[model samples]
Target: MAVVNRRGAQRIRNGHPWVFRSDLERAPAVAAGFVRVEEYTGAPLGFALWSPQSEISLRHVSADASRAPDAAWWHEQLRTAIARRAPLATESNAYRLVHGEGDGLPSLVVDRYGDALVVQLLSAGVNAWTETIVASLQELTGCTGILARNDPAARDREGLPREVRLLHGDVPRVIEVVEHGVRYLAAPWDGQKTGAFLDQRENRVLIGSLARGRALDCFAYHGSFALHLADRAEHVTAVDISAPALARVHEHAQRNGLTNIEPVEGDAFDVLRAWYREGRRFDTIVVDPPAFAKNRNAIEGALRGYKDINLQAMRLLAPGGLLFTASCSFHLSRGLFFEMLQEASADSGRRFALRAITGQPLDHPELITVPETGYLKGALLEAMG
Candidate 1:
């Protein structure tokens, strides 16, 4: 059993599962499988899924140094993860099953949409056990189809090739899914985040319930909130930069026999500014933009962008209008996001009542120890006269 030299031992002891290359004394020739982690003094620490090509050299799978990363261990872990998500299946047809390390299975995320399973491998250790995980998913979920969308940029750091492949039964181009009683057709390859924004399922339901009178859904990719809002609101205008996404929204509305949605394709900021100039106002607004601040260096600029966009949107809100704003950037702290929103509200001379503050859905588990795991932050505010 090859051990994790010295520094790797301390990181493991510290509760971090990753084993970086620099922590090694000398590179050992080991196949992509379970490897022993040990101290320089030759004391065994744990067992990890080993991969030579990944920046995350190993993923700690078991604290007991003897257990191997084999089919039995993989099935056990996958079954446990599935059981945890069993409750979600009742709540929504589209939901995340395994969230990588958050589920104690590093570098692996499996989202279930109806009978199909979408798997993403984010690191070398997970890639090594891909077959095991896939087989277990099929056996446990009785899933008809399994697709791999391992295209995250982080995979490059693991020296793994990005790929989208079908691993099991045939999958349709568009699959019907229902969330909070609203139906949607999610495309596999084309849709964002493994065929639809399952992360926004609960948020859309919230928007639908709160929507009334005139509503606007900005940066509304694929009309998640727009379609739902249109179902209950007097009218809804959905804006997005991607014409295709807007088209999909329209198609979805048509499929559901809904006609209260208006799809607009343009830059969200420009459209919001134009609406403000036209003196057009809405009773409720949903501002769910893409990540503006991906890295720390861009945080200042991103904050300004978020503030500017939000300021324009807030200005167009009629008295007592509700605003649901969100930030998906892990680098953008909740404190910073709230501060930016406060600046926007103050600049617009608006007194807002905070209705709610939330993070991602239950499936997107946030570990208490790792703050980075909590990326999605949101606030529901109402502009009071």
Candidate 2:
């Protein structure tokens, strides 16, 4: 059994599933797996995944104080998470089936891309059940193949080796997917976070629906946003720091038969600054950069970066134009994100209307109780000046 201090008990009671190493009074003797969680006085709290080696010692799995979660219980949780995402079959073939703590299956992430499934066991406790998880997924998804994208640094902290191997069936190097009628390719073998940023699916749809006039997609990695904007916008400028990524953008645009997309190679910050100084304006602009803050220590600088790019984007926004800015940094809180945009608006000296506050798609469920489950947030702003 794993024992926790008073503070840890209170944290679990408050709906937080993480019990830090500092809060853990005693961990289970086993190397890894589920264990009974108890308070200092031996009062049963729940069942949690006991990862003795990681900084997060206990990850709460079930609140059933009486029953320990067995293999059947975990199977049901996986099934429930999969069933919750059933409605998305019609909208797109690519989506997140299991969102770790968001789905009450902590430290386990399963993303589906077309015929393949990409899984990440982020914690030692979850890693122990990799076989069970893969077996259940093969039965549940009936997909062509399952690949383990377990190369995340988090595994290093958990005392697990990093690897990207085919777990079951046959997964291809490249998988094509469609989201809201926009088709794109996913490199499940060697691509960004489960091949693509599935969390931004809804945001892409929202921006595409309202795209018009000259649009600019800053930090357009593989041109996901640019592809959507080109469908409705008169012209589109897809900017990226890497010329190779821009090359992929050109290929994506060409494959989609979108001739209006122009790939621009440059840093988004420098380009935005140059555009505003040159009196260059766009009717629509999307500033979806890579996570500026990966940890708490970087939050201060990340906010500055966010504010600066947003401020420049606001200046380049024509009257009655749209600006869709987003941040994927979990370290940057949603409240802080809104506050940063407000500060940017004040600095821009422009009247901005908050058309919509965007968030993750239906597939990427963000629980209110667990802030870590959610990271993607954005705003659809209109320049009213």
Candidate 3:
């Protein structure tokens, strides 16, 4: 059994899954795999996946110390996760089936894009058990194929190489999925974050309903938000830095017969500034930028970036217009994000009324103890001036 210090034991008992290196009494030289975690007194605490090199040395698998991390256990976990998301299947065929720690399967994420499943192994422990996980997903979803997108930056810290390839069956160039009556083509092999940003599924629908006249969607990768806004807004401009992403946005718009969405390829910040200088205005604006802060050290710079983008978005909104802004950086706390928005509003010199605060969908459940699992943060505000 791997013995943890009092601090680690107390945290585990309180529902926290991570045991950092600093919290350990004595670091064990066990191989990078599952081990039975116990208190210093030799009392069993739980079963954890141990990573000797990571700062997060221990990730609790189950409270029962005797529970084996076998195929049957993983099958049960996959089954339970699928059952939990049964309600979401009716609304959207494209949804997150497993959200790593959120689904109780640490460092493993599986996203369903219709008949195809995209899996991400973010840690060495999960990578070691990849075959079992892929098999379980195939059995549960009867998916035609499974693609391993083990290319996340987190894997680097785990001492794992970045890779993307087919694991089970054949994966076509494009996979179709429906969300809130909108049809989207997800390129799992080539696109970002397991094909698309499924975390903002519900948020897009909400902002879509509030859209009117003209809408601006910043960082509009493949036009997810812009396409949704097309249903309500007279015109929507989807802006991104990647030309390929913009091209896909155009293709997606054509697929949905959404001629109202215009794909604009450029840096979002530069475009927003130019639009403001040219006296361009919009009734609705969505500022869903990529993670400004990848780690804790970048938090200060991220806050400033968030504030700048939000301030520009606010300025672009017409009187009584709505603004939907979001930050995907887990390092940025909810309080800090809200505080940045407050500062942005103040700097914009606009009277804004908060309409709603949003986050990841029901499929991506957040454990109260694991705050990092609740990374996506969004807010809807009405510009009064």
Clashing pairs in 3: none
Predicted candidate 3 versus true structure: per-residue lDDT over 1-385, tens digit per residue: 5788889999888888889888877666767777888888888887888777778888888988767688899999999998999998889989998988998888889999888899998877778788888888889899999999988888888888899989998877788879999888888998878888899999999999889999999999889999899999999999999998899899999989988998888998889999999999999999999999999999999998999999999999999999999999999999999999999999999899999999888889988888978998889999998
Tens-digit per-residue lDDT, 1-385, candidate 1: 5456667887788777777777776555877667777777888777877778766677776887666567988888888877877777776788989988778788788988889989998877678777878889989999999999888888888777888889889777889888877788888765788888887777888878888899999998888888888877899999999988888889888877898999999998999999899999999899999999989999999999999999998999989888999989999999999999999999999799899997888888887765656789998999898
| Model 2 collision count | 0
Weakest 10 consecutive residues, lDDT, candidate 2? 66-75
Best by TM-score: 2
Better of 1 and 3 by lDDT: 3
* Models sorted by lDDT, best on top: 2, 3, 1
Give, for candidate 1, the lowest lDDT window spanning 10 residues.
24-33
Better of 2 and 3 by TM-score: 2
Off by over 4 Å in 3: 25-30
Backbone clash count, each prediction separately = 1, 0, 0
State, as a TM-score between 0 and 1, how close model 1 is to the true structure.
0.94
lDDT of 1 at 126: 74
TM-score of each: 0.94, 0.97, 0.96
